[model samples]
Target: MPDSVLYSAELPAFDRATGQLSLAAHHLISAPLSFLDLSPPGSTLLFDQPPAHPYQQPVLVDDQPRRKRRRTALPSADASPADFAALRDKRDRQTTTDRESDEHHAGIALDLRAALEAVQQGWAGRARDEGWVGARDDARVQWRLREAQDERPELDLVGLAAAQERQTVETPVRLEPPRAHLSAAQLFNRLVLNDSSSSSTTVDVGIETSRVEPAPPALAALLFPPRSGFLMSDLSTWSAPSSGIAALGHAKGGWDVVVIDPPWPNASASRSSSYETFDAYDLWNLDLPALLGDKPALVAVWLTNRVKFRRLVKDKLFASWRIKGTAEWWWVKVAADTGEPVWPLDATHRRCYEGLLVGHYIPPGTKNVALPTIPQGKVFLSTPVGHSRKPVILDLLRPYLPSPERAPNVLELFARMTLAGPRAPSIDPLPPPEEGKAGTPPRCGFYLAVGNEAVKFNVLEREGGAVRGWIRQSGLEKAEAAACVPEGQDVERM
Candidate 1:
């Protein structure tokens, strides 16, 4: 019989609920491409075999081994300094692996060449889309150089500075935040009208009035009726009146869940006085209508700390979306060693937590879904902070995800570039056809969990065509034979 224990022993899955660890689910999601270190690991396993395999099985190997995990070998008194250096290098390598594992529960890598090409194309496309011609050619060149690492690994700051210096004209700043006194309503109107002309706006409310309106019809139709009368916008975009007020009016279809992460413009250090920040209006202006335009759903917004943003989200954003209050979930990220802020012997710094405010966009005269009430008893557990930290909505919130998995669509409005690995394909918000050119598609499409965004995947071969032995990627010298998929077997892009 073929070895059932297929693939390498690199992947491991941990079940926090049962305190169990087992082999990761694996099938064809494996690729030889090396992602220069940014992609999330795609689903490393699949449910192809019978469910008879022992899952959640933990090995009791060295259950209580007396050896210390962080032990250093002391040098002999007569040992040379070089001997100590050699031993230290070996120890460092071992220690770093452990740290990396703890940091990345699900590790994934992307092909370096593919990643570089993506970056180059990503910058170039954005520049073209935004009419930023001055930066396109130079940016692509710089990226190529960086990818090759011919001379330097750092981005060519000098070339960029030179290109920027060559620009003869200056961009006009017309829509500065209003200096004169303006009522909240007028300020809101100006913001909505001036979004395209200017990238930044601030609303200074004077004598705020209760001008909240009803949810939009399009939004209501998309979601099943909510328990309350409003929908809250995510924190970053909750500043606009349109963002956090009652829905604009009814929508088309009803929804079960809405996940939003607004991009409140985070200004990096060393920037000028003002920069582009995504206000509530910018985020919700298009999507709110699109989402509520379809279905009424339970909505979840990830938020950072900011008192003004918070109040706007709760009172204004939620009210506008027509999503009523449900419950709040706090996502706490703590290092394994450093328990909490008040704990002693804490080594890590700048550990912060986020909040996931859950609400529902209810429609008028709609009945609420009845279910058993389960208290969130001790739901305040903590985990380590992963990059691009969002609540691990899988365990508690998986039920909200669409089941029967037929082209289940999801959208992340304010997403960064796609990460590789298990959650990769599903995390984006565009569809395969619209993601890229007809032939040159993005690899992120291989991540299959999401469908609403512009996603691109390699067509290893035309559907129903003869199978080959290997596949050829870009930057390669010759065409490779395609992997042979058994007759009628699904050959998903890895």
Candidate 2:
């Protein structure tokens, strides 16, 4: 979180003219990290090392023709050569292939090749010249090996009673959410208001909202560990008859922008076991449309490159949700050290990049409206952060907000960390509707929202030894003042 270095060094620089933002993923993730020591004693800090290759496409051992083996790991005792032949027959008759999915997804990348190329050569070039880092520290491996020694081995037999006591759990950082029976809505409100709640801890961005009065100093951006976001929250409460979601529809107003990163089921993500995945059908329970009421919205969703997800969003999800497809943005991941794509752009299987599908949500019966166009094929290039983590995107999305003059209500569903900056103002005692002030609750409902997975990543730091949303002492406020304040102005001149 070298906030001072973020904009000044020009790595995370955004050329307002060209609509590109480039910076190392760690710079964004490091914003709140004041001081942290996660490695076991005598271990090297993993953050100092370069990020390794994102993923290497596995070589298919079965691709080459193989001779029959005397004893193969058979599926069952009754397995026979006929069953093997049947499998080959089924494969021969299958019309669909993973290659087809690759081609369809590659089509998307090909369409945006020029745009992404331009950004890479231009803005990313400028960032590299200005010294933006390509990668940063990650200690996942070191942490895993060291943490194991801290455990009491089951091998301690009765005869081994003379053995030394097990290692004390000195670093008690938790990698999982604490069990709590608190209401998700209440927990969210406590976070927004910076109030203490059952979550026990809060991660606040010490920045002022777009408030009319002199703003309070931004709160300490600490740690958040609640598990209410989409990953593992008991979702029944979100849609129950007596739940706050019903109130969200009427009491709260509509959001300006909604960003959702649903934990869609995937073979890779499932195998990684990073967090819980949800069935596609579970999304309906979120009542996402209800959060929008009548407001026109800029919807940004993070999607995997799989064709199933792309089709789900384009063919079925959008139609049922009344969200009109508008544009697509690709978050191209490159290496921090070499500043190149982690995997080849032409590589088909195990592709390195992810998609951020941008769309518009307008309630039924709304007409004669004007909305800002989302730049098609926008490219956001940064090194990959941890699993399922994305760079901070509030600034890039600012242009398309329903109310672009200032901040608008934004909801980040399935958010890993509470976004690390100024949020839309929340006035508990709303201004009278007749007054027509900005704080007046909208007729629709809560415009912007985030899921309960807020603290999921807080635990990631504990388990993997990689910090998320922590920053260096160069505070964002300092960055803003240095960038905006006059060079010769005295402290009180303004």
For lDDT, the strongest prediction is 2
lDDT for each candidate structure:
0.30, 0.46
Instruction: Find the 10 residues in a row with the least total lDDT in model 1.
Output: 219-228
**Please, what are the lDDT tens digits per residue for candidate 1 over residues 1-494?**
01111111123445445576654322110111111111211111100111111222234567853533323457789999997998888667765445553242222111212222232343343333422112122211111121232231222212222333222111211223221222322322111211111111222223333463542211000000001111112233323334422122221113334566654444431143211235545444443534445344556777654445555676677777676644454443322222221111111222233456776556545675442222121122232222342322423443343331211222333432122111112234445554565432222111111111101111111223232101112232121222222111233531
- The local lDDT score (0 to 100) that residue 307 gets in candidate 2 is 70
RMSD of each: 21.2, 15.0
Model 2, range 145-205, lDDT digits (tens) per residue?
Answer: 3223333221111112123232221111222222222222223322232111112233333
TM-score, per-candidate, Cα-based? 0.33, 0.56
